[model samples]
Each structure stands twice: as C-alpha cells, then as structure tokens.
Target chain A: MNEKVAKLYQERLNRYMTALDCGKPDKVPVSFGIGDWIVKHTENNFQEIFYDWEKSIKAVDDILPEFDVDVFGGGPTLWWPPMWDAIGSKLYKFPGMGLDENSTFQFVEEEYMKAEDYDAFIANPTEWIATTYLPRISTEFENPSSLRGISALIRSSVAFAEYNNYMGASWGKWTVEHGVVGQFTGMTKAPFDTLGDALRSMKGILLDLRRRPEKVAAACEVIVPHNINYALSGAGADTRFPCFAPLHRGSYPFLNPYQWENYYWPSFKAVIEGLWAKGKRTYFYAEGDWTPYLEKIAELPDKSIVFDIDLTDAKKAKEILGGRFCLIGGMPTTLLTYGTPEKVKEQVKRSIDELAGDGGFILGAGGVVMGDAKKENIMAMLEAAREYGTY
Target chain B: MSEKEKKFVPEPGTCTPWKVKMEELGGIPGNEEIVKKDWERLDETAYNFLWFWVHR
Candidate 1:
C-alpha cells in the first residue's frame, strides 16, 4: 500500500460517511465491481486463475487503483466454496446467465415433495440441509481431487481478501489502515421468494403461488428465517452496513404488483427488521421495478443507507425517499455502454444536483457492470461524481 | 369487481388456490394485492441500498 494512496482512501471514506448523512464531503467516493465471469472473459481463460487466490486479489487490485471506489466488497456467493462443495454442483458457463454453478440436489426434483415432503420441509429444515444441502461440501473432503479444488477456492478467497486489504492501504489514509471491504452473507428473500426457490421449481414456484398459496406461505415461514440467520451471520451481527442484491428477474414483468406485495413484502420486512434490530443497516439493491413497493419500504425503522435501483428514476426516488434515507444509484448500464462520456457525465451531474441537494446521495451505474459495459463510461461516471459531488 | 376483489386473480399461471396468503387483514386486494404495494413502499430501502454503493 502506497502512503499517498492510503491517505487518499482515508479522505474518501470520511467524505462518504459524511455525505451519507446528507452533508457534503471533500469529494464523492466511487466504487466499481465486476463479476468473476466477466474477469475470466476479459482475461480470456478460466483454468487456474479462477482458483488462484493471488490472481483473484490481483484482479481486484488492478481495478481499484484506477477506479478508486471507497468500499472494497465482494459477494459471499462467490466466496463460499464450502457451500458450493457441499452442493456438489459443477459450475457451468452460460453465455448470458454468467456462471451457472448448479446445486447438487435437485431442490425442485419432481415428486420429491408430495405434500408429505412439504410437511417434512417445514418440520425440520436441518433435515433438508442434511439431505439436500450439506452433501455438496462434505463430499469434497471425502474426494481428494475434489478436496484440492475446494482448497484452492478457499485459499483464493483468503488471498483475495488479503490483497484487497493490502491494496486498500493505498486508499485508506493512515487513520483508516485497510481497505473497507464488505461481503454479502445470509441474504434472506421475501418468504414467497424463498418458497419460490425452495419448494417450487422456478416455474413451479411461480405457478404454485396461484395454485397453492397456503403451502407457499408455510414453506416461506420455515425457510425465510434460515436465510436471515445466514445473511446476518455472514455479514456479522455488528456490521454497521451490509449490502444485499435480490435479483427479481422473473418477479418483475411477470408477476402482477398486487401479488408481489402480498406474497413478498412480509418476508422482506421481516428480514430488514431482523437485521436492523441487530444494529446492521442494509444496502438493498432493487433489481427491478421496486417502484411498486417504495411506499411500504419507507416505513423502515431506521433510514441509514440507499437503494441501488435499476430501471427507475433517481430523481423520483429522491423525492419519495430523500428525507428518510440516502439515494445511491440510477444511471442505466445500457446508457453507460452506448452513450458518450459527456452524456454519461451529464447524467451524473443531473443526478447529483437534483438528488444530492441536502446530501444523502451517491452515484453509480443502475446495475452491475456486465462484460459489455464500456470501461470508458465507468470512468466517466467516476469523473462526474468527483466533479459534481464536491461540497 | 371491487378494487380489492379485482386484485385477487390466481397467481400468474395458476389457479387462485396456489397464491401466497397475505396475513395483513384486508385493506385492498387481500394479501396478494399488497405484495406489489409493499414492494413499492420500499423506496427508502432502495434509496439506502444505492446511497451506500455510491458513497461507501
């Protein structure tokens, strides 16, 4: 960690903390994240690098030095090799879906749950964990070859974190000694969402809601707390802030708004409240038109962070949630990909000027940076934040 | 149909018996109607999620 880089990082973190309170910072902080598949694709290979801990760290290090985002975070989904090992699923590369690391048990296998199985799923979840889940990782230990692969994955995550901190020293000034890296864990979804994943096949989950509402609710109740526990445990109970992304791909255009609220909101509320009570704040990434759920979300007990919303207007979001909570993202990934740098900058400035009025605002691409998003546009977003995010 | 009743279509591709039941006593759309409504209410949650990403 370079002394100068450390100072820059510390100053940036301070500014960010202040700005989150709706106060001006010395300058705005910027962060960027790229998925592993994207990195593998860009590098044109996946073999050992994906499993190489040092290379993983370098991959992030290479990006942060130039991009200079305040926080250095990674997805727990990517980190938990043990969990993947337990599942015994192979990571299949899908052209557009990113990486498809299929789960070991066919969670949605036909006739596995003939009402009686549902009874068993609800009565003792550990049974499900033991039968359907734990085998994925436990098997790796038994198989030496598989164990080696698992070991590499674990080592790589450790290395990734180590390098993240080493590199973070450059960003953190002396007072803030290391990179502020946060990882997502225990991401509980709406009861319906959990039910959708657990009891029903993707299609079954969707259809079950219309056909077997009670069963879905029962399954959700049984599973949602488990997810909440996992998320909190992964994030750490005292975590001041944790990030969560619930990819509502099918739920969005497919489900009607009314059905969404009744089935999903309670589980979401329960999870948010559970985390909040434990003194952890959440940074929820609203993947789709959460526009339908904004009013209910406003009722949260504490308004600590922002929502990284996609396909929604930040200005409108600010109007609805500005006084209560901070606002983070809104720039469209597609716009960033296709638009000119100036156009990107203009959007950033508008977002900042309009939403950053009383403070409590940050800027980012509306969604994750896929492989296709132009690197230049990402830089443009950073520049615009720096230029306009000043006090 | 009444506004609340209108909200009670069977879940997307299935019959009415398959939907998740809303525990919230009826205001409109029974429990099903409120799922979307409750999601919309999360503007603050959304705001905070983005705010942290940008600022942190």
Candidate 2:
C-alpha cells in the first residue's frame, strides 16, 4: 500500500469509529450499500460475477472509485456456486446450475426441516447437520453427507475444507483489500431467523410457532452457540471488523411483541453478548421497520454496537437510543431512485438534523442501492451528504 | 418490455426485478394491474412522503 493511501484508509476508518463513539468528526461518514447494481452499472449482468470472483472485483472497481464512501461493505461477496450446489442450499439459485447464464442468482425459500425432525435436530446437531440436513437440502451432498462411516466423514470434511478455503480466501481478499477498518468479520443471523429462513420457510416457521412453540424454541437454542462460534472464529482474531447480524424476520410487520420477545430477542441478544465477551462488537442491519423494537434495542451495551436502521424515523430512533447506541443509516432507498438531487439533499439535511444531532449518526441509505437506482440520484445522494453533512 | 414487468419486485426486495428474466416463476395473474399501480403508487408515496419530510 502506498503511504498516502494507507494513511487515507486509517483516517477514514477513524472518522467512522469516532461517529460510532458518538463524537462529531470533521464530517459525516457515508458508507456504500452496494449490490448487483454495480454489475448493471458496469454494463454486465449478475451471472458474470456470480461465476467468477475476479469479475466481482472488476464490478467493484468500475463503480467504487466514483464515490468516496467511508466504509466499503464488501461490495458483492459472490458465493461459490459449487459449494451451495453440493450442500443443497435451500435458499439459493445460481446461473446455469439452476437458472439461465445471464440470470441473477436468486434465493429460494422452502421448508426443508419438518416438525418431526425437531428431535433429530435437538439430538445431535453436528451429526444431524452432516447426515440429514446436508443431503436433504442438496442432491450432490447425499453420499458425502451420509457419514455412514469414518471414510464418509473424511470425504465430507475434506470437501468442506476445500470449499471453505476457496470462498474464505476470495471473500477475505476482497473485504480486507477493499474494506477500510476491516471487512464485516462474518454474517450472523438470529437463530430463529436461521430456522425460519432455511430449515423452515417463513410460513412453516409461523405455523410451527403457533402449533409447536416448544420444539421451535428448543431448536433455536441449539443453533445460538453455533452462530456465536462462527462469528468469533470465522475470521481473523482481534480484527476490527464487527460481524454483521441482519435482523430480517424479526423486523416489524413480521412479528408480534409476544412472539418476538419469546422467540427472537433473547437468543439474538445472547449471541451478541457472546461475541461481546470475546471483545467483539456487532453491526446490526435491522432491516425493515424496527421502530417498534428500539427500546429493546437500547438495552445492549452502549457504543459497542452500530445499528443501521431501515424504515424507522431516525429522530424517534435517536430519542429512544440516546447515547446508548450509534446509528448508521436513515436515507431511504426511495430518495435515491426517484427523488431529484435537491430532494436527496433535503433528506440528507433531515438526517443531519435527526440522526447526526448528537454525533452518533453516519448518513447512508437504510438498504442496498436499488439495482435500478438512477445514476444521477446516487451521485446526488453522496454529494448532498458531503455538502450538508460536514460537522 | 411489459409494463407489468416494469414494476414487479419479481425477486425479493430490489427494484430491478427484470434484471433476472422471471419466466420460470410465472406471474400472479391478478397482480399485473396491482403491480403497475403500486409501482407508480409506492414510488409516488415514497417520494411525496420524503418530499414533505424534508420540507416540513
């Protein structure tokens, strides 16, 4: 790294963490919420990068230099199609393997785990995961996941290690080289979200919650430690990159307080606390409307967590989270796709007024850049922040 | 190039649903108009709501 480039990276990193410390830096920090939009922006389709890591980096390089975002959220971490195809990922569809060559990789949700399997799941998760879950989810993993004997275990273990080495090395190179402070260490999910998203479809989980609450709760317990362990051990030791735990199913319009409190909050909070004990902080992309749960959110360690909120009014979130947490986003994606440059500025001004008030705010869209977002508006989104957001 | 295709989330949550040709997923028959209107309606609601939030 050039001396100046490294210094610039550290300066940008410091500016971001300072806001997280609830201090006003020289200016407001803005982080990019990238997606396949960059692929389309660079005159390519999703299939190009979905198939190759180098292409994904090219897509990042094509557009990232245009804007100076304080944090790079590892723009487009493409999955290893071979690994998912082997494991029988219940939630993914990639190019040519399942969809057309030019098609964007998609997530397919199905109820893979049945109610009766709760016993099998709670019995020996590691064994059950290798034998039952793997094969049931992916066609190729059947023979490997059987673990009928030691040879089978060795085959699957070696296969998994190779897959891990491939995906981990590529993703790490992109995140470390591109990420300023560090890349988000790894992704985490609320154990219930994991259960809902993968094992059970959203509908399946909702019904299970109503029909067999205890089984689902018990299943969630078995998965919590795994989430914590992965977050802590999945990446480099003592890295500044906080593992991101995106709360999707727990967001508003999806759960009642009774359901959220009993099922989601405790386990998710435990995982955060678990990482916290290891000196790890978490960056939560509380997707969708989380205004209803801001009070519950305020209970976590002050300044140790950064909350990137969506849909919730920032002024109200700040009031509830006053000095108890740092806030990252409030600019809605709507403003970027349809609003004019002036409109984008106005929203940035409002975010400054609301979230950037006590110096805990970093201005950004609540979610990823819309794959169809207007180029002019995206530029405006950044420009407005720099102009009005200077502290 | 269909107007219905113009606005359907076709996939999960992003705006460029057409980025993937969703022919395999097929269409929800009654949703054509609902999507067209909502596409315009939601965009308008969001922009209008934001326009007011900033000015207010």
Candidate 3:
C-alpha cells in the first residue's frame, strides 16, 4: 500500500476497532454494504455480479470511491452459483439460471436431514454430513460411490477453493486501493440456525421441538463445538475482526421465550462463549425484533459481540446493551427501500442521536438492504452519517 | 469393515485428522510435519465445504 492509503487504512481500522471496543473515537464510525440495491445503479445485472468474480469486484469498485464509510460489509452476491450447479445442488435458485437476470438469488430450504437421522447426526455429525447429508442435498450426489457423484464432489470442491482465492485477492485489492476496512473476518451462525436453516427447515425444527425436544437439544449441543471451530477456521483464526453470525430463530415470535431459552439460547451462547474464549468476538447480526431477549443477550461478556439492531427497538437496545457492547444499525432497512432521501437523512440523524451518545455505536442500516432499496437513499445515509456522526 | 471401524468419529473442524490418518498409515518414513501440514490444510478445506451448506 502507498503511504497515503496506509494512513487512511490505519485511521479507518482504528475508528472501527474503537467503536467495537465501546470506546469513543474522534468520530462515530460508519458501516456500509454494497447490497443488491447497487445492481440498479450499475450496468451489470444480478447474474453477472453473482457468477463472475471480476464483475462482482468491479461492481463494488465502482461504488467504493463514492461512499465514505469506515467499514465495508461486502456485496450482496454471497455465493458462486456454478459451485452449486457443479453438484446439481438444490440449495438455491440464482438469477439467470432459474430466475430472470435482474432477480436476486433464493434459498430453497428443505428438510434435508430427516427427524430419524438425529441420533446418527449427534453421534457423528461430520461423518453423517459427509455420508448422508451430501447425498440428500445434491442431485448428482445421491449415489456417492457412483462416478457422477464422485466427480460432482471434486468439481464443487475445486470451485469452492477457486472462489475463496478470488475473494481473498479481491479483499486485498479493496483494502490497498480503497483503504476500506472489512466488516468481519470469519462467518458462523447460531447453533440452532446451523440445524434449523438448511438441515431441518423452519417447519421441521419446530415440529422436532414439540415431538422430539431432547433430540433437538442434543443435536444443537453437538453443533456448538463445530460452530466455534468453523468460525475460527473460516476466519483463519483471526481475532482482529469479529466473526459474522447472522442469528436466526432466536428473534421474537420465531420461538416463544420458553422454547428459545431452552433450545436456542444455550447452544447459541455456548458458541459465542467458545469464540470469546479463543479471543474472537461475534458480529451479532440480529436481523429481527429481539427486544424480548435483550437481558439474555447481555449475559455475554463485555465487548464479546457487536450487536446489530434491525427490526429491534433501537432506543431499548441502547438503554440495555448501550455501555456494555458496541451497538450498530439504526436506520431501518425499509426506510431505505420505501422512504425518500430526506427521510433517510433524518433517520441517520436520529439513529446517531439515540445510539451514538456514549462511544459504543456505529451508524448503519439495520439488516440486509434489498434490491428495491434506493441508491439516493443510501448515498443520503452515508453523507448524513458523516454530517451528524462526529463525536 | 467392522461396526467399530465405521464409527471412527473425527474431531470437530476435522474430517480425517492427522492422528487418524497416521494411525491408518501405520508409520511414516519421511518428515511427518510436511505431510501433516498439507493434510490439515485439506482437512480444513473439506470441513469448510461440509459446513458451507448449512451456513448458507
């Protein structure tokens, strides 16, 4: 990196690190993401951004110069569809392949792991995943010993490695050129989500909770260690940045407080504690209303998480989680999509006022901004964050 | 393979650990660290691959 870029990088990194530690910096750090919302602004379609690595970086490159933010969360296109296609994977329907070119990817959730398989999974989770889960999820891998199934595994694994290499290089370029500090190093999930998302599906997990509660708990307990390991391994054991944990099922209404406390919170808390033990903090991406569970979440160690406020009550979050943890997100994602630029700026000002009083706050949109989110609104948000974010 | 052999569960973050592989290989004649390093790297890659499905 050049001397100028290095200085800029240090400034941004210090700003992010300061806010994360719940300490006041010279200014309130801002977190910005290049979501699918950027597609409308660019000439490239969703398919191109999702499939071609170069195009994805270029799309982000086109916008980085314009937006001045402390941390870049990353682009909307999370996966390379060709890897899924290589295995004839039925996981997601990406744009151009299954939907229109302009459309976003869709996850096809199913009960890939049957209820009966709980014991097997608990006994030997990794082996069970390799032997049973792979065959069930990928069409080509139905018969693993068969030539097609074997080849599919090889092709997809190669694609996974290829994508990782490309992303690592892209991130390096972004940091060197744009002096943009990355949002998080590694990725993980709540242990319940590790099962409830792709393996059991929402309906299946809920059914298991009623009929086979003990089994559900056991499965989640088994997932706890693995989730910690995954988070650490995924980040290459980097503790400098927090690991992204897009928490699911722990939010309100998804699980009654009783079910959440028993089945979800134990294993989820274990994962966070395990990461903390290893000197890693989790980026708690709480996407929905978690007002009911604020006290339980606060049980975590100080500075163990960067709490995200999406649909949750922001003022209450500040009141409860304010001084203890770094609080991010205040502008509601809906306001970005439906509200005007004027409203966006207002929300930014309001979020900063309510959340950034004490030093532990980063101004950002609450949750994933969708394709319909307006570019003008996003720009307004970034501009306003700077205008009002000064401490 | 016996039922006991079939139930050789690997540790978390590993599919076939170096210890398990070393046991399977009986004994290594060459430098073990070199082989172990590559083995663990690939094991991590495979672990990431398996976990990728659910994380999505």
Candidate 4:
C-alpha cells in the first residue's frame, strides 16, 4: 500500500464527501456518468469487456485519471449477461443479442407486470419477482411453478451476489488506485420506479396509475422496503460515499404534480426516509427533469439526500435545493458529446457559480455520458471545474 | 482552452502515479461514424432507460 496513493484517494474521497455533505470543499467534485462509453472508446469488444472483469479493467485503463475528475467512474455498472441469459430476457439487447458489436447494451421497454396482478405482486414482492417475473422473462424458470420459483430465484440471487462481488472488487480497485471515489454505492430503485422500470413498463404503469390508482399505490408500499434493502446492499457503504437511490418515471411529462406527489413520490420518500432511519445517507438520482416537483423534493431532511437531477436549470435547482440536498450534475449529455469543449467549459462554469455555492454540487453531465460523448469535452468539464470551482 | 489559473494540480504521484498514455484511456479513431449511428438510435432508449431501468 503506497502511502501517497492512499493519501490521494483520501483527498478525493473527502472532496466528494464534503460536497455530498453540502459543504464547499477545496473544489467542485466532478464525475462522469460514462457507462458503456468506456468500452466503445477503448478498442475492446463490448461482450468481452462487459462480461470479463479483467477485460473491463484493461478497457477502461486510467481513462478516469487521464481526464482527472474529483470522482471516478467507468465502473462495471452493467448487469452481467449470464444473469440476463439465465432469465432469457426480452427486455435488454446486449452486444450480440439485438445490437451490433460496437454498441452498448440496449433496453427494450415492454410490459412484464399486468395491472390485474397487482395484488399478487404486492402480496409478496420477493416471491412476485422470483416466481412471476422470472418465469415470464426466462425459459429456465418457466416452471418456477414447481418450487414456487423459489429454487430459480435462489439461484439467480446467488449468481448476482457472486457476479456483483467480482465486478465490485475489480472496478472499485481502479477507482481507489486512481485516487478517486465512485459515483454511487448501491442502486435502490424508487418503488414507483421499480414498478415502472422493473415490473411494469411505462404504458402499463401509466394505465395502472389512471385506472387502478389504489392498487398501484399499494404495490409501491410493498416496494419501499425492497428499495431500501437493495441500496444498502452496495459494497462500498463503509467508505466515504454511501449508497444511492434512483427515482424514475416521476417527471412532469409522465405524470403531473398531483400524480407524482401521490402515486410516485410517497414510496420514493419512504425509501429515503427508511434508509435514513437506518443511518444511511444515500444519494437519490432524481431522474428526468424535476422542475415541477422541486418543492416536494426540497422537503427531504437537509444534507441527508443527494438530489442529483436532470434537465432543470442549475440556478433554479440551487435556489430550491442548495440548502438541503447536494446537486450532482448540470452539464447536459448532448452538449458534452456534440458541443465544443468551450461550451462544455461554460456549462461547467455556470453550474459551479450557481450550484457550487459554499459547496453542494458535483459537476458532471445531466445523464450517463453517451457512447458518442467527446472525451475532450469531458476533459474540458473537469478543467472548468478546477478553474471556477475553487472555494 | 483558457488561461492556466491556480488550479489544484496533484503532487507528483498524487494521482494515477503509474500514468499510462492518455490514449490507453481508449479512443476509436474512425468509429465516430458508428458512434453517430448508435447515438441516434440509442438517444431515446438511453434516456428512457435512464428514467426506466426496465432492461434486465
């Protein structure tokens, strides 16, 4: 263990934790949501890098340090293909499944949970995921009927645990070795998001929200505990960065304020409150534009939640959220990929000026860096943070 | 791209000390065309997945 290397890692961790604490650090912490873009940028093939931990390590190399941000990324965030294959998934198209060799994995949105089956799902969330969801998606578990899908579910869980351990250790090593903290710990999907994303597709959830509102609400109540469990289960909880919960499908376009406040938000809030009660302060990736629901978002206990949001103006987000929650991103992904480095720098500057007040902002893109995102622009974003982000 | 301001440059061995060439970070020279095609197709799916993690 190199003393200086450990010191660098500590320094970066403190910078990230300070920002997460809603206090100004020496500089604004920057982390890119670069997912599969790393593999695409590298000469590595998607299948090899996506599945093999060593291959992914080689694929990502020191790209994180090369760009040099306060926080590290390009972790093995992708769920392994073996699990997907075991499930015989129709939802995602990996490198060879439905996509070409060069592209990142793609997800296809389709209904997996039906409206009428809300009670069955709510009856036992784990059982529903195991018996109902698993068999529906995969051929192997097509007969979870025999053991009530308990065996298959157990196997899948075991596989996930093993795979996650391997990937977590491997990717986590790179982040630490490069003297950077990762972007997130655990990923707990907000209950409503869990419904919309995992069980029900957008169409299904939207229709359920309209026709069977109470049932949808009931289902989310059951999902809250599961979300909390999943988030705290991430490997790096003991470190500087805690876990993260992702709230999805609650944006204005999908649901009005009333719908979001009622159906989507309560369970999501429960996930936050539940995790907080257990002494875990997790970042909430408030997916989609949160302009309509910033007030509701502000109600979370101060400095206990990270409101890493998208599409909303940083100035307004700061005004609304800066007091309580740390803001994680402001640079738009499109701008990072398509615009020049100067434009990227300007965005970084504005975000720092607006959201980095006394330090409560992590400077980065609005969403996961797309495959096409220019590295120069990302470099510029980090450089801009150093220039304008100093406290 | 701007004047070198007083930024927090890490001490020698402060960052990734065994610094590999920046290119080792990965860059596909001519794949910009593939990136474009993949970009257009994945734009909606990507954002959609961001909001909906329905992918297995």
Scored by lDDT, the top model is 3
Q: Per-residue CA lDDT of candidate 2, range A110-181, in tens?
A: 777787888887765554554576566655455652454334334434444565566566555544554444
List of chain B TM-scores, one per candidate: 0.27, 0.36, 0.82, 0.27
**Residue range A310-383, candidate 3, lDDT tens digits:** 99989899998999999999889899999999999988888888789979899888888899998888999999
Q: In angstroms, how far off is A286's CA in candidate 1?
A: 0.6
Better of 2 and 3 by TM-score: 3
Off by over 4 Å in 1: A1-6, A19-24, A36-44, A47-49, A73-87, A90-116, A133-186, A249-251, B1-56
Ranking by DockQ: 3, 4, 1, 2
CAPRI category for model 4? incorrect
Output the lDDT of residue A265, model 4.
Answer: 86
Once fitted onto the true fold, the runs of candidate 4 whose alpha carbons sit more than 4 angstroms away are: A145-158, A235-240, B1-56
Least accurate stretch of 10 residues (summed lDDT) in model 2 chain A? A145-154
DockQ for all models: 0.02, 0.01, 0.80, 0.05
Candidates 1 and 4 compared by TM-score, better number: 4
Give the alpha-carbon lDDT of every model.
0.52, 0.68, 0.90, 0.68
Clashes of 3: 0
For all predictions, the C-alpha RMSD in Å is 14.3, 17.7, 1.4, 17.1
lDDT of 4 by residue, A260-310 (tens): 889988988888888777767777666677787788888888877877767
- After TM-score superposition, the amount by which residue B25's alpha carbon in candidate 3 deviates from its true location, in angstroms, is 2.5
Answer with 2 or 3, whichever has the higher lDDT.
3
Q: Is the docking of candidate 1 incorrect, acceptable, medium or high quality?
A: incorrect
Model 1, residue A150: distance off in Å is 14
| Off by more than 4 A, model 2 | A86-90, A100-102, A145-179, B1-56
Weakest lDDT window of 10 consecutive positions for candidate 4 chain A: A233-242
